[model samples]
Target: MNYLTVLGLSAATLTTISFLPQMVKTWQTKSAKDVSYIMLITFILGVSLWLLYGILRQDIAIVLANAITLVFNLTILWLKIKYGKTRPRKYL
Candidate 1:
């Protein structure tokens, strides 16, 4: 791969991986009240747009990165909705 491609992929990998901790925490604790609905929604929208842009540009790096990030964010959003009640579900 070219330098630019490597750079893009590396950046994408790091950014995407950053969400793992939050995802795992939400999954285990079943609590997402601290998470903002607006933030997540807005980010999702932005990422969706970026993904579309990437697809249009035919940039594999942009497409792949945004696609994976989209999934991560979506899953987090789903968990936020599912476990966003007043009290966190106890972890066993």
Candidate 2:
């Protein structure tokens, strides 16, 4: 493979690895109250667009990186919804 492709793969690997800790932490801690809904949603949207762009451009690096990142972010979003929810208080 060419150096550029290697570079791209290296970049993709690092970015993907970087996001893994958050996924693991969220899963282990089961606490996502601190995670922002807007940020996660916005980031996911942006990543989705980037994935589409990569597909159009036929760039494997961008496609793979963003696709994995999107899944990670979506998992976090799901964890946030599942763990961050609180039962409403009842008043007698």
Candidate 3:
């Protein structure tokens, strides 16, 4: 692979993996009040667009990263909808 491809993959990996911590935290705490609904929704939309763009261009790294990001973003969105109204724990 070329240097640019390697760089793209590395960036994709980092950005995609960054969502994992937030996902796990929301999952474990069962609280998403701190997570902004608007932000999550906007992010999901952006990521979905990126996925479509990747599909159009047949870019593997973009497709893979956005696909995974969509999943995480959707999960967070769901959690926000489900638990956004409740008061979350102070410590978590």
Candidate 4:
């Protein structure tokens, strides 16, 4: 509850939750045609590192946001692996 912590939480919430839309869309559509596999892989690695950093530092905001982000990223990565190479129209 200090002002800075509140700001931290807000920032964390926004940045973290921003990944949700992409995850849900990919999950529902099962299409990641436009999403870069390289980007997803790199982003996942970065987030995982941040999650580890958060755990080491005992930072709640970092931990919570990165944990949620990890889930979404993993889902998107899975979808990409499962569907990225196939014909999009076939799925539709």
Best by the TM-score measure: 1
Using lDDT as the yardstick, the better of models 1 and 4 is 1
lDDT of 4 by residue, 10-49 (tens): 9999998898888888877778888898898899899999
- Cα lDDT tens digits, model 2, 1-92, are 89999999899989888878988888887777678999999999999999999999999999999999999999999988987876434458
Q: Give per-model TM-scores.
A: 0.92, 0.89, 0.88, 0.87
Residue range with the least summed lDDT across 10 consecutive positions in model 1? 83-92
On the 0 to 100 scale, the lDDT of residue 43 in model 1 is 94
Q: After superposition, how far is residue 10 of candidate 3 from its true place, in Å?
A: 0.5
Ranking by TM-score: 1, 2, 3, 4
Which 10-residue span in candidate 3 carries the lowest summed lDDT? 83-92
Error of 3 at 61 (Å): 0.7
Residue 39 error, candidate 4, Å: 0.7
User: What TM-score does model 3 achieve against the real structure?
Assistant: 0.88
- What is the Cα root-mean-square deviation between model 3 and the actual structure? 2.3
lDDT for each candidate structure: 0.90, 0.89, 0.89, 0.87
Query: Worst lDDT window (10 residues) for model 2?
Result: 83-92
Q: lDDT tens string, model 3, 1-92?
A: 88887888899999999999999999888887778877888889999999999999998889999999999989888887877777666683
